[model samples]
Target: MPEIAPLLGETLTSPTAFHAPLHAPHEEDQWWRSSVIYQVYPRSFRDSNGDGTGDLPGITGELARLAELSIDAVWLSPFYTSPQRDGGYDVADYCDVDPRFGTLDDFDALVGRADELGIRVIVDLVPNHCSSDHALFQSALAAPAGSPERAMFIFRDGRGEDGSIPPNNWQSHFGGPAWTRTAAADGAPGQWYLHLFDSSQPDFDWDNPAVRAEFERVLRFWLDRGVGGFRVDVAHALIKAEGLPDWGGRADGGSTEGFPGWEAPMFGQDEVHAIYRRWRAILAEYDGERILCAEASIDPLPRLTDWVRADEMHQAFNFAYLHHPWNAHALRDVISSSLTAFDAVAAPTTWVLSNHDVVRHTSRFGLTDGTPRGGDGIGHGDPQPDLHTGLARARAASLAMFALPGGIYLYQGEELGLPDHTSMPDDARQDPTFARTGGERIGRDGCRVPLPWRADQPSSGFGGADSTAAPWLPQPEGWAGFARDVQAADPDSTLSLYRTALQLRRDLRLGAGSLSWSRPFEQSDVVAFLNGEVLVVLNMGEFAAPLPPGTVIAASTPGAVEDGLLVPDACVWILSTAG
Candidate 1:
């Protein structure tokens, strides 16, 4: 550990100069409070030119599908220019679309088509870091030590005699050292720069005025381009502890796996609130209730809501709720606590079951005694996923999440009940975690394989019908069973379940409502709650339970209630008069 020293720039100070209006005086509607947004990972969504990788045009072509799914908005993952080191998280340019995905014109066209279908667009904003190939980083590498260009990044002199070692013991989110040694123009080992993620992505020094102003400008550029909002990546990480002191061993990127680093110097510092306060003011200048959804993985649970206070971001991902296991007690406790905390701040809570960075919930639920862990080591060894059992629990979980108050996010292919391709070959793996862990971990590739569109067509119809190019991440042969075409025709499929639930959620006015548990019951195996007019019940136990008092309106599994009994591992939506 290194001794604490004064921070490089100014001592943390108050942001009283920043004005965040509590009320949007001219707001049209706060749609995000109840919006069901769907997340689309650009590289795996669809291939328009048959280049074997998904692009913006492909997404534009699929807007009708999203309209059919009844999503209020689409949160497109990074389509920005990138080296693809971290699946576009390592951005080389914030303003332009990557040629691999499409041109800037193509992106504008995507927004146009989605708008025609009444779907808002929320583009991802990667503020904490940038790719090494980014012009700013390139200039930093070419500049001399202590130069203004270098000041934009966290460049520090190494501790050792020859300055060959890293400035600190901090580790990267992927693995290994967080600081990577940079070379001078003469080929000598020079200073080290901070990269909390992969070496290809360098962390920005928020202490620098240039960095702060740059991001604010980027936000306005997109807002002016007609985007509804931005999904902030690593929202809690822009601010670091005073001296960058060590907390524990390397962190698993913001996960709260009983680790001491959950509150470490690297993440969730109090100063971060000031940054979002300024951003809220920026959003206030816009017409729509433009939002900032924090992908913050803060712990102690309550602090997650802090990012969503009236003066700050509009929503923060409910990571703890998504990480809970299938146990009824645990799920109920998390839900109650989450709703209570967010209600106190008057901020909407966001629920998400699957994202591009984690194992698909279907495969995760399939694991026996599944404990929700991060994307490392999930697709490695045996005890192969029991797809049958996993799909059942996932369907039930979807209904339960939809019934909760506040907003919800649907990851691509989640509606199709796609399980993680646990058998992806080691050679095909691309997640930074896999390489950083030296094959000890399989990473998140299992969940990112291109989605299956048509069952009989080549490329699973992810591209054109006769295209011979394969998807960037190969789809498994078994994927045919879960293809969108096949599931679209099956009324009993998970796709149908999601569509029905989403429609009912809107029709029943479920989102933004209050949630309360049902009256005391003897069967602890079943957890039941009422949100608006919908009564949601989930039976996690092995045996069937008596159905709650309600009219069965929808169910995850067909015939979930037979002979007035709710089957185990099932969930149902009912219209009940009882609270």
Candidate 2:
């Protein structure tokens, strides 16, 4: 057993400093070194087919936008076969595309097109579980005792009454029990199979060799299709609590939080990096210059370096920002901790503000809904207005995300400053969880709503022929106000800001983890940062902070840090000098 060190001084004590590495850090291929990865939720991107569902062809057509912006890569959500249980997150088959998304050929075409545009293509890989409709589950249901398929799914020995119940105490992410009896046994009668998410998405048993082999095959399938790399979904969740114990927590404990009697590993587990290393080996087979930005949260930096060896997942998402308070101290502490981990792990990092899963950034900084009253634990709160206040915070966040070290992932609509539209009628809920779980889960439908491609066009220029005529979700009121068309023309628009930041990242080695965050002084309202030599200030309050003496590099809102008393809820800037 490794000796635990009592971390003292500037760093926290830890059992072991993260040093895992699946692949060596690429100093030369800086394309993704500190690249800002912008995620595109296909359904919300342009709808090319007019089927009301975003497809591969549409992504291919829009590849130029990312290339022109010099975004290192585009992380597309699962276009694979699925029951759409969790917004195309549940995979029905690893090798095929769901018809609703288009054909495998279409995927190939999109990949080819993205490559042509110099934009790398990274598909989301959901390996933790598969759609209940997946053939492997069905085949396993038919397998006799000791059959390989039987070992694929977590089918455990049931105790007591109706064998339909599982052997552990875990809750499904969607709701209800985690285990359900498989009645369609080809050889065996009703037995139990565990599902951490929805009944339709059953967890895969990584303890089994066959299961591992099958997953390898699935990964190779995409690599063979000329994919740059993969965005591992719930990467650490690949391994479950070996001892199925009841985890105490009303909030979906069984899924990962519900470990009864044990260490109950959740997001990132120690044994999981080995699996990532295997992926590294596979990608190397094709000489692919790609990365595996793990969708890991909790135990991320514990073994950060280990995950991105010359071989494992290249980067893991630093969610410190997601979990931190909306204050300079909180942000500073999170970044400081992150830097320590990055230094310890020797592995690079992936940073994110908003993704398909979380609430939009505009809402997080008291911009949108202003603030959620109490932890009602309901939806991510109503539409966050005060755009005046929110927009400033957003600009600060953008500068911070871009200036910080590692790969930064921008949500699809973030570039345009789209806020979640909470004004939708109650009956219009599009998320299955909201419809099934009463909206507390805050399903991602609002952010996943269709993209507004055209400003003048009602369909946001996505489609006018059916799909464009009627989007999957209603557009936010402030959307057309910042549409791409309008922003494309306005040099000061958010889109312009996004492009400028990305360009600076590429041209200047700012993507490299060379950021030295200046100590954030307790000011009136704005938070500031010294990016290299330039001080980036963000205004969070309604009023502007006085402009501090120095040349201003950029300002999110009309605010400045004068004499140290910064403005309210806005970003401020000052250039750095060798002196």
Best by the TM-score measure: 1
The local distance difference test score of each candidate is 0.82, 0.66
Overall local distance difference test of candidate 2: 0.66
**Candidate 1 overall Cα lDDT vs. reference?**
0.82
Candidate 1 per-residue C-alpha lDDT over 1-579 given as tens digits, one digit per residue, 9 for 90 to 100:
222112211111112211221111112247888789999999999888887999999999988988887898999999999999999999998998999998989989988998899999999999999999999999999999999999999999998799987787888888888999998778899999999999999999998889989999999989998998999999989988887876564464454455554568888888888999999999999997788899988877887888999999988989888887878888877887887787778777788888988878888888876544556636646567678888899999989999777889999999999988887888888998889989876778888899888889887888878789878998877887788889889999899888888998887767756666654321376777766556677888877766644478889899788766778789988776542
Q: Give me the runs in candidate 1 sitting further than 4 Å from their true place.
A: 1-29, 253-262, 369-372
**Residue-wise lDDT of candidate 2 within 386-458, one digit each (tens)?**
6555566777777766766667888887888876665665565666666556666556666676777677776
